[model samples]
Target: MPNGCDDQLPNRLARGGYSMRVRFQVQGLLLVLGILLSGIALAAKAPVLGEQLEYTLKFRGLVTGFVEMNIAKMTMAVEQEMGRVDENPAIVTDLHLTTEPYRKAEMIYPVRLHYRSWLDADKLHPLIAVKSLKTREEKEELLWFDHSQGEAYHYQSGELQAGSNSRPPKNLQGITALSDEQWENLLQAHQVSIGGIEALDYISFLHRLRSMPLKSGKQINFSTFNGKELNAYLVKVDQERLVRAGWNRPAFRVRMWEVDSESGRKGDDMVDLWLSDDNERLLLRFYAERAFGAMEGILETGRPTGGKDEGFSEATRSSLETYLGF
Candidate 1:
C-alpha cells in the first residue's frame, strides 16, 4: 500500500519475496498508468485492434516476469451501448502480466494479473474497466463510467476462488444508474465524482498518454483513480533517445510523479518510460524505483497488425530528423 498505488500488490511486494517482488515489478510497469497526464490534442490516432506487444520485466538485471499488451475489437452489443452515448466504437485493450519466477520460486509463489478496459475510440475515455489478480489469493475489480449520466461506479468482489484463472467477464455489469446506496458509498470512498474533474482509470489513462502530442520538455497535468483514491499526477516529456528494442529506434523519455491535489506538490512515487517517437508510440522501455531494489521493463517483441497510419510519414520523419540534427 506504499504511495497508494494499489491496496494489495504493493504490500505483497514489500515483503521482499523474490517471486512476489518480480510479479509486483511486472505490475509496476502498468502501475505507471496511474501517473500520467490528460488534455491537449494532436493528429495521433488510437491504437488499432490486433496490435500486440510483449515486454520482459527485470529485477536487478535478472529476468523475473513478462508483460503483454493487446488491443482487441469490442463486441457489437457493447459497442452499441456505448454508441448510444457517443457515435464512436469502443476499443478493448488487454494487459497480461505473469511471473517467470526464477530460482524455483514458481513452486513457492505464482502470480498473474490481467487487466482490460473499454475506451472510447475518439474521446479515449474509459467506458468500463476490469481486472483479475492472482497471488496467494484471487480478487476481481470492475469500474463503470457513465459519462452521459455523469456517474461512476466501483465494485469489488473481494475474493473469489476461481476468479484469476477465469477470463474477463463478457457481460457488462453495473451499467445501470447509480443507486442511492451506491451513491452514498462512492461519496464516502471518494473514488470519483460524477461531474468533478475528469479522472480516467489505469488502462484508459495509459492509452490517453499515447494519443497525446509528445514533445520534449512538455509537461501535462492529469488525475486517475486506482480503484481506491483519486490522485493527481504530472508527466514531463524529458528527452528523445535511441533505444535498443530489437533494433535502434528513436524514442521519447517521459517521467511521471504523483501530485497532491490540495497542495499541488509532487510525491515520491516516480516512474520513467521510453516510448517510440512515432505514430505507433510503442512502449520501448520503463523503469520504476521501489523502496527495495528497482524494476525495469524492456520491450522484448512488438508486433503491430499493420493497420493504416502506422508510423510517421516521410515528410514528418524528415522534419523530425532535421530538428534533431540527425
Candidate 2:
C-alpha cells in the first residue's frame, strides 16, 4: 500500500506540472499575438499623415515644370435639412502642377493647375474634388460626390476676374450648405452620375493607386469621371527594375489605357507609370504622350538617395527643342 501511494503522488505532481506548462504556452502565444496586432496598426497609421512627394516635369528631355503631391488629415461634416450632421474622419490630397516661368514649353501655353481630393479615410472613397486652373483664364470647379445616392454635384464660379481668384472656397462653407432643391437646380447641366459601381476623378484615382494591392501580372479596371464624361481604364501591372535619378530600384510598371464608355472596347490614350515596390509606393516616374509631345515626370529627389542627370545630350536636346519650336 505504501508503494502504490508513492506512485500516485508522482503522477499527481506530473499532472500539475503539465497543466502549468500548457498555461504558460498559451499566455506566451497571446502576448505575441497582441504585440503583432499592435505593430500592424501602428505601421498602417504612421506614414499617412503629412506625406509629400515632389516631381520634376520634363518635356522632350528638358525640365519644364514641377508637380507637388501632398496628403493631410481632414474632417468632413455634412449637415442635412433635418439637423442631422454626419461627420467623418477624412484624408485630403492636394496636387499642384505648374510650368516653370520662361521655360521653352511654357512659352506657348503656361499652366498652373491645382487639384484637391477629399476621401473617407476608412473606405478610401472620394467625397469632394476641386479643380483650380490658371492658364489663359482662371476657373475653379468643385465636385461633391454622394456615393450613398450614387450621384455627384458640380459647382463652378464662372471666371474669377482678377482679384478674387486666389484661394479655393472654404471647405463645407459653400455648396454643401445648400438645400436639396438648390442642389437639384444647380445640377441641371452639370449633374454627373455614376455609371458603374463607383467613379473616381483624377486626384482620387491617383490616391486609389497607392492603396491598392499591386502585384505582378495583375490587371485592374475602374472608371474615372473627368468633369464631363465617364472614362473606363484597364491597367496592367508588372514588376521591373527601373533606373532614374542615379537610383536603381525594383518598381511596379503600370500600363494604363482607356476603354469605350459604352462598348468597353479598347481605346486610346496610353499612359505609363512606375511606382516603387516599397511600403510607401512612391510614384517614381510618369510618362504620357500629350498633344504637344511626350511629357515625362520624374521624382525630384529619388527614393532612398538620388542624383540628377539631364537625361539627354546637349546637341540632341538643342535639335529637339528647335524642331518642336521651343
lDDT leader: 1
lDDT of candidate 2 at residue 181, scale 0 to 100: 41
Taken over the whole model, the C-alpha lDDT of each candidate is 0.56, 0.53
Tens-digit lDDT track for model 1 on 1-326?
Answer: 01112234334544666565555644554454323212222335576667776665544312221211121111111122332223547777777766543323333345577676788887788887666677777766667776766666666653333433332223353332334442222211223565766878867777788777877778988877676667788888865554332435557777888898899989887888787777777677776655443455666564233323324322233434544575
Model 2 lDDT tens row, 172-237: 545345444433333212557783567877555666786676777888898876566666788988
- Alpha-carbon error at 270 in model 2, in Å? 0.6
Which pairs clash inside model 2? none
Clashing residue pairs in all predictions, respectively, total 0, 0
Over all chains combined, what TM-score does candidate 1 have? 0.65
- After superposition, the stretches of candidate 1 with alpha carbons farther than 4 Å from their true spots are 1-43, 61-88, 100-105, 159-171, 174-191, 244-247, 302-326
Model 2 misplacement above 4 A: 1-47, 61-86, 101-106, 159-171, 174-189, 303-326
